[model samples]
Target: MIGLNHYLIISGLLFAIGLMGVVRRKNLLMLFFSTEIMLNAANIALAAAGHFYNDLSGQMFAFFVIAIAASEVAVGLGLLILIYKKNGTLDLDDLATMKG
Candidate 1:
């Protein structure tokens, strides 16, 4: 049967993958996606713990995290779109020399 350990392990793996993507990807969109993944991993862990402990607080926190992640995605995507339009590329290296 699946247990807390299993959930924790899965969450850990997901978080690691997200971290790698955030570190290695050069695209701004991919970086945002990676951050979302990490947030989801935290949500999963929180929900799992809430279930295991029969408590509501962890689940509530997970909901809050989800809301925050959604807002972050919306804002990040908007900014990325503007940046892409202005620069014509999503490459981080190319954006490094950006000036106002």
Candidate 2:
């Protein structure tokens, strides 16, 4: 039967993959996606722990996290759109040269 350990292992793998993407990807969109993946991994772990412990705190925290993630995505996408409009590209390496 699946247990907390299984959930935790899956969460760890997801978080690791997300971390790698965030570290190695050069595209701004991919970086945002990676961050979302990491956030989802945290949500999964929190929900799993809440279930295992029969407590509400972890689940509540996960709900708050989801809300925060939603807001972050909205703001981040807005910024990305603005940046792409100004730079005509979403490549992180190219964006590094942008100056005021």
Query: lDDT tens digits, residues 1-100, model 2?
Result: 9999999999999999999999999999999999999999999999999999999999999999999999999999999999999999999989777576
List the candidate 1 regions with Cα displacement exceeding 4 Å.
98-100
**Alpha-carbon TM-score of each model against the true structure:** 0.93, 0.94
Candidate 1 has its poorest 10 consecutive residues by lDDT at 91-100
Candidate 1 per-residue lDDT, tens place, 14-98, comes to: 9999999999999998898899899999999999999999999999999999899889888888999999899999999998785
Candidate 2 accuracy as lDDT = 0.96
Residue pairs in steric clash, candidate 2?
A: none
